[model samples]
Target: MKSKQENITIISIVIVRRFICFFGIAIIFVLNGYAQINELSIELEIVSISKGNYHPSPQELIKGDTFPKRIDFEFIVYNNSNKMLMIGSNTRCYYHSDGKETNYEEIGRFLMINGTDTIPLYTDRYYLHPNPHSSVKAIWGIIDSSKDFKACPIFTPFLKRWTNVGKDNTKELYNYLKSSRFVYVPILADYQRVLDKLNNKSIIDCIIYPRNTLEVKKKEPFSVFVGYLEEKDYDYIYPSEYK
Candidate 1:
């Protein structure tokens, strides 16, 4: 269980992490047959994000330490692909140091869609150490996964609840994890990082550098879906002054 102070830290970390786009590097593993690539597009919107404190379920804790709490992020996603993209919640977590990400782990999951079948994604209430260093300062990215259901391809980060809270939209930190109120994001670029790697692998990974702070401004209420295909992949690559 986390103490009240720790809860605040957890929420702060989540909000900070949201600013960083999680990169999906190809997993270094054996090849499994590649799934047919269908036109896939993702849309996301985070309405409200806030932090709070709570206790862990295990009930075992250090004498002076409380369970870590987490921030709750209320967000939405859409899948505008030609074929159905399977998305699950349990996503990946990465930490950064000196402008590079080093710590990576797959924590929990969620399901989402391109307006086909909508789902909500939440985070576990308890705060897991964002990093090992005491002065840990870095952004995080939530990468989606495809391992929830067997043979489903599992598009990581499909919006779904990861809380044990009974049908309640508003829940405390501890109950959120117990009831599965968390969610995840899919990593289209990092297909090779899994235990079974995909066959047809070409690095489609991208880094978006918005020209000015005002360039990629969000028009609130709705979501924003950006598309990027590497220069070599397309015959005629559109030139962007920002890049």
Candidate 2:
């Protein structure tokens, strides 16, 4: 038999090894749980055009010079998971223009019309619970005419429409606008700890914005409308002409 002192030392070594193994296993479980908790699944579908108009402001219409074309779209968000997901009040969605680095913000205050009542998109925690889904309508684009050098002047007449063939007339422009994808960032209740990890990263160089990795499966196809000014006659014109 081993000496009493030697046996004590061996027992202590065994306890330490078991403790380390338990600790490692625990860590792995924790990380795996984190990954699952952070995961989100949802769907987004562009339903229809809510409004299409060209006018920076009502007061500026007298000048006959419209710089920005505004177009609004109706969209639906469907919850694909069995569990309820929470979207914060300040949640924002961005449109990626033809996979370019430039991103455009979805206009604030998307209203949900529920027959007699109208609800704002943002809530303390927009609980997307199970199957049903939510509908929201808001302005999607405010494209500036100045961005395209070849763009026709806002007040250009219909007879001189041939001169207006530029960036707006290209199939690439239409495809670019149509192919634009939206990235939505919403806070999830189970994955709140992910934000802490983001905070630990280098804040000075990185813009840390958290977005859910919910695959947006489209149930319906959507169309885009281009807004411009059209002159009906030499003396009369339509301020908001959508095509």
Candidate 3:
């Protein structure tokens, strides 16, 4: 019933609407891809012995016994995307040496700073909320957590007195320091795996939801102090200097 000119105009309107919708969808896809590629940036650096306070002094040296010291590994995570990221407390540190890989699961206690409050990452359910352009530091170490003095009540006094005498070669601390080469430490956001799997699911009621993917910003590894070995000196530096 419409005129030829009116029909042509209607068709043109439909075509323009379709083109606009298609263009908007394409822009969303591009932005989403960019966000996925660079959601979070991670940088790792070795805190020096002096800065980390892990080296011991001469007064704490014991004769003929191996002293235990912790080597600190620091992780700086930055949220590069606009969306808020949820980093799980299940963070892990990997040490690569001589084609062999050793994993150190969250050792001692690590903290996450969100705004003014410092949240401790000790429990299994803890989550870090790093907003856009915000950064958080997660500190881990090669300290032995298996030997709980409280668990061994009978040997508590003896263990406390002879802390520097016993060395567990099978533990993580021994293997971490034994490597002569530069330790390749990678701090991974293990929670990202959960986020990847929940791409299509509704995470509103979920206790732990995924955010942006954590990316490594720096290509090179950051160096840190391992240990000092003096010539003919059997005593090595302990992480904590005993007065």
Top candidate (lDDT): 3
For model 1, residues 90-171, the per-residue Cα lDDT tens digits are 2322211132445342333343323344333333222332122222111222322322333342322222232222231222
Query: Model 3, which residues run further than 4 Å from truth?
Result: 1-37, 47-68, 91-127, 130-143, 147-221, 226-243
Residue pairs in candidate 2 whose N, alpha carbon or C atoms collide under 3 angstroms: none
After superposition, which runs of candidate 1 have C-alpha atoms over 4 Å from their true positions? 1-41, 49-71, 86-189, 193-219, 222-243
TM-score-better candidate, 1 vs 2 = 2
Tell me each candidate's TM-score: 0.22, 0.33, 0.33
State each model's C-alpha RMSD to the native. 25.0, 15.1, 15.1
Model 2, 143-197: lDDT tens digits are: 2232222333321221122122122232333343345443343444433443344
Ranking by lDDT: 3, 2, 1
Cα error of candidate 3 at position 45, Å = 2.2
Instruction: Give the range where candidate 2 is weakest over 10 consecutive residues by summed lDDT.
Output: 158-167
lDDT of each: 0.28, 0.35, 0.38
Relative to the true structure, candidate 1 reaches a TM of 0.22
Worst 10 residues of 1 by lDDT: 207-216
Candidate 3 Cα lDDT to native: 0.38
